[model samples]
Target: MARLQLRNLEKDYGGFKAVHGINLDVADGEFMVLVGPSGCAKSTTLRMIAGLERVTGGEIRIGDSLVNDKAPGERGIAMVFQNYALYPHMKVRKNLSFGLRLKRRPAEEIEQATRDVSNILEIGDYLERLPKQLSGGQAQRVAVGRALIKKPQVFLFDEPLSNLDAKLRASMRVRITDLHKQLKADGLQSTVVYVTHDQTEAMTMGDRICVMKEGRIMQVADPVTLYNRPANAFVAGFIGSPEMNLIDADLSGSTLSIGSQSLALGPAMLERLNPKAASALTFGVRPQHFSLVGAGEDNALEGRVSHVEFMGHEVYLYVNVEGQQMIVVVSATAYDRSKIQGDIVRLQPSQETAHLFDRKTGENVSLADLH
Candidate 1:
């Protein structure tokens, strides 16, 4: 196992900066995930650590050793790519033992290693089969098994499961996580760095998730913390399945004006805001935070139902508030569309779940002191 550290790491292509100065520390034996949309520089960051891309500035270290000057093979790291990259003519056994063969390891040693990995991955039955003869999931296992044979200190995965179907992808996510646990049980210290565009993958498999946007790191935290207490509006909108609803509002002392409606700020929330510093703000509320309420209830907003999605046990309501669109989620058992009056509904946001952000900076004003 190895501890990885990036000190003001940067990458530039002529005049274009692909990665900005960023710093991160990954503990030994940790499973860290880098996730973001395309063009966000997550893959570039992973390549830099693997020695596939040169750093424009700052240092890259692995286990107290500077690796910026080292070749990929000399850095004690193994990588699995999105395409699997297995040889077409090579059988499963040959693909897994290819690296060791190149190093001229003994015949018996190679046989033993191949047997162990194949058994662990449950692919022993197909060792003699070529890559073309295997299914997508089986081929992926061979690719991962090839990397495992190297026994490197760090494992890097670059969207290794993106090629599979939804069901295969879900199963592979669990398989990879279990593989990590198996490695630990076998007393092999293994550190992993995974990159993906899927937020679900990051939330489910990572020990900690790093969210990036453009060329900069946005936020890094455990899944629950990232969801509940986002550092900024971008994170609040990015981490959840149904994105958080952000509405423009004007703040004056303890009163918040959303369109033509007003909500009195609770004392705890009022203490967190500086009225003189911010007049215009963005009020954020997640879909699950809004609940159905009586039309005359305090802090309730009246809206017409634009659309409704019946999702088995839960229902999502798309509401048009004035000119803005907002989404609300409710239990299907508690809400029935046919009983509504004039297709109009009253939704109220729980005061304790409200999030306030600075309109100009996009920073979460409520969490100013926490960061």
Candidate 2:
């Protein structure tokens, strides 16, 4: 049982702290993703777990072992890098078996392991090809095969799919998730810690995702929980495609004054608000949560269409609400093409899914009652 745990894990680069004291746990056979924008200390945290970066404070436990002082190879972890770090001079087979060869395993054992991994990754045909002869996707497969060949207690991936194109990245995402399931079914220790800045990757690939900001962890949860019930304004904005619309407003007696328009927050929505909520708030609603309604509708925000994007199945309507820009996604078939720029529209936000954040703290004041 190789359950990974970090207790107050920290990394201090000289005087500047890169990773604050953060605690996390990755259950055995679980795929955990660390995701955030650049400079969020996610990669630093992954390196520390792989023993490449020194932990300034706290403990890192892999099952029964405390491996903060161990070398990278001694941590029973295999890492796949973004660059597909296969040995340039060696063929795919040789690259896959290098670690086993270094440990002086018998030739038969190394060859069998390489063959097994190559088949699993579907790189058997490229066994004799050098790294330079392979395409980006093929090279990435060799990198994953190399890690799989190790059968380590934990697997670490550092933006492994970022180098590939959009289409390839999508395919590889499915491949990696399928591989994790395959390993788990085979009773292998498949604990995975994957790091990426892409929220889409985190959402689709991880069993649970850990979101970090600066040197602090923002939130850790499954994709559904993070999307439908974000803990704060940051997670609500960061995890979505076009991002959640966060606009400043004044909440007075179950009514929200957004710019020049006033919205009556119905009693059901009012009951869901935190009792300690303040008057000043950052109203949060996703673009998809907004419905295009008739003009002069009650409890709706008035806006004028500024721009529109005609996606195949849906239309992205960009509107200027007062001075702030807001986006509403409507089905292409339902959108009237006659309503072009400068057209007035009303957007009704779904009260069940709307969020209210404290203006000063950026904390979701309506979150407690949501649960």
Query: Can you write out model 1's per-residue Cα lDDT over 1-371, one digit (the tens) per residue?
Result: 48999999999999999999999988888899999999999999999999999999999999989999999999989999999999998999999999999999999999999999999999999999999999999999999999999998899999999999999999999999999988977878679999999999999999999999987989999899999888888889888889899988888878888888888888767766654447788999999988888756787888889999999999999999867899999998978655457889988887677789888988888764664
For candidate 2, lDDT tens digit of each residue in 1-371? 88999999999988999988999999999999999999999999999999999999999999899999999999999999999889999998899999999999999999899989988999999999999999999999999999988889999999999989999999999999999999999899899999999999999999999999998888999999999888888899999888999989999988899988888987657877898898999999899999877654578888888888989999998888878898898898878754433488888999889989989988888867554
Over 4 Å off in model 1, which ranges?
271-277
**How accurate locally, in lDDT, is each candidate?**
0.90, 0.91
Q: State how far residue 138 of model 2 sits from its true place (Å).
A: 0.6
TM-score of each: 0.96, 0.97
Q: Clashes in model 1: which pairs?
A: none
Q: After superposing candidate 2, which stretches have Cα over 4 Å from the reference?
A: 337-342, 369-371
